[model samples]
Target: MSDMEDCCDLQLCLDEIPSTFNLEKAVCNHGFFMMAPNSWIPSTKTLRRPLRLADFSASVVVSISQPPGPSSTVLLLRVHREQVIRMLRLSERDERNVKEFHKVHPEAKDRGFGRVFRSPSLFEDVVKSILLCNCQLSSKRKKRRQEKDGANPVPAEMEGEEVDLGNFPSPKELANLDADYLQSKCKLGYRTNYILKLAMEIEEGKLKIDGYEGVQDAASCRILIKGISGVGSFARASVLMCLGFYDEVPWDSETIKFLKHVHAREGCTKKTIKSDLKEIYDKYAPFQCLAYWFELLEFYERRFGKLSELSHTMYHKVSSSTQMREFNHNHVL
Candidate 1:
């Protein structure tokens, strides 16, 4: 019998297998699962972002050990332990410092911010950043196209109609794709060239995501990722928080609006925001200021709907709801 079959038999003998052993179902319900020699371990965290979770799933499978080997038992356990640690976010995070950050951003209380989670592999994070470029939150056409192209749009689905875009593409898969094909699949407008360029660079080994692991220093990682094409300050900072272990203060439009409301400034510029993030994080060694920052933004969004009105005055016109729906229908179908 194959190692996987042996594992299954052992699980049955030990009565450790759960009644529900469906990988897809378990993953959808719990956000992630760790494949062990004799069991499938489920995570407690419900993935809020389905697409991101899908990416994590794909990447994890690749990194995990394969079945059908004598040593597979050891490999499976090691990989399972690692995956569990990642899913639970039970790595070297400083909880005390995170709580202090929440205290300062009182508005973000109980929002579940400051939970430091591992991001997918570097290649996946970079691709995700590229996908997000020049895209508005309400752009349905673009999102629908992504859905139709086999990308998981949501992390998990509540209803029959929802579609989950799986994780970002691997370097080998992405490198093989043409620019036009990527544009059509991702609905990447002017950013098509950037994605292609990034893929090529990664494939050629000029850029390496694995090298950035364990740095913990946000500034250093930010500078490293920013060197890639299409990765600007905002994208770099956000990706660093998600993938690299950097606790970054994301200075997106939403965050800027909240900062303006609280501080009464025109808004914090990218340079000023980056400086402030560095300064704030300096106090908490190895703790990220980003958790509090995300909490503050989520708090603002919950209290007051979209901060669209704030951006409307300062930025160009965004897509209307009707237009967004129409776009979603066409591409998603």
Candidate 2:
């Protein structure tokens, strides 16, 4: 990160650009955008985060920005951490999914959106998914970010900035960590063993998560991902969604909150939401998760404000208290 001239830049050609791509909606549409090692910089209209280079030698902090000129074909990325450039480089399937998803969801089509941002690496998505399980999301997100910052502080890419940013620990890094260390340092509680085992499995060649990305069948993908040590139903569905198979929506407290406010489902639990979502949401087919997500997002905006403008650390902001307040104020009359 030292050499000032070591900065790398990439120009994405028109062929790679989506016809209706909007960077803000794609990156900020998901809570993952608010998690550690990922950030949406509103001030600069860029997404900044640490990316592990293809060589796997190191993680480099990269800034992805769209050009301000008339050209719509290219995105400019300036990464001072390394000479290699990569950030959300999409595939043909990804583009096609965006197009197909936009067609069904009118609000998304109107906004030129449908893709939710995820880590460029499948490993990062997997590990983050584990941490998110059995915990409060927004708080756990901040906790994981803080813990990671303290655990692995990388040198600041900026020359004069006396602050160093944290990188999410890579599989190799986590594989070498002790369970006690992980639990205590990360405050991971019971999730410590799941993560430790998962990292070790990947490191030892017992499991290959990246291969799961090519899986097109939802049920098969779920089985394979859940085969991992720590990945259960929620985490498996989450990883599946990350892999672009969104036939299922991962249900949690937020799912209940969404069902309550948006669908007026009084007693929908995680167990029941899937059936409910199927009847209400499955017509969208493979994009059921996307459809479900936008409904939740639109409701959030209607209640709170634009998610892109809100503090990224506070996702959804849908604690029971928040919902109760909304209910009382709106339903009191």
- Compared with the true structure, the alpha-carbon lDDT of candidate 2 equals 0.65
**Candidate 2 residue runs with Cα over 4 Å from true position:** 1-7, 69-71, 79-89, 136-163, 312-333
Per-candidate total of colliding backbone pairs: 10, 0
Q: How far is candidate 2 from the true structure (C-alpha RMSD, Å)?
A: 8.5
For model 1, residues 223-313, the per-residue Cα lDDT tens digits are 7887788887666765775553545554666556655566554547755766655554555434354544454544544664433222112
lDDT of 1: 0.43
| lDDT top scorer | 2
**Residue 223 in model 2: shift from native, Å?**
2.4
> Against the unseen true structure, what C-alpha lDDT does each candidate score?
0.43, 0.65
What CA root-mean-square deviation does each model show from the true structure? 11.2, 8.5
Model 1 RMSD, rounded to 1 decimal: 11.2
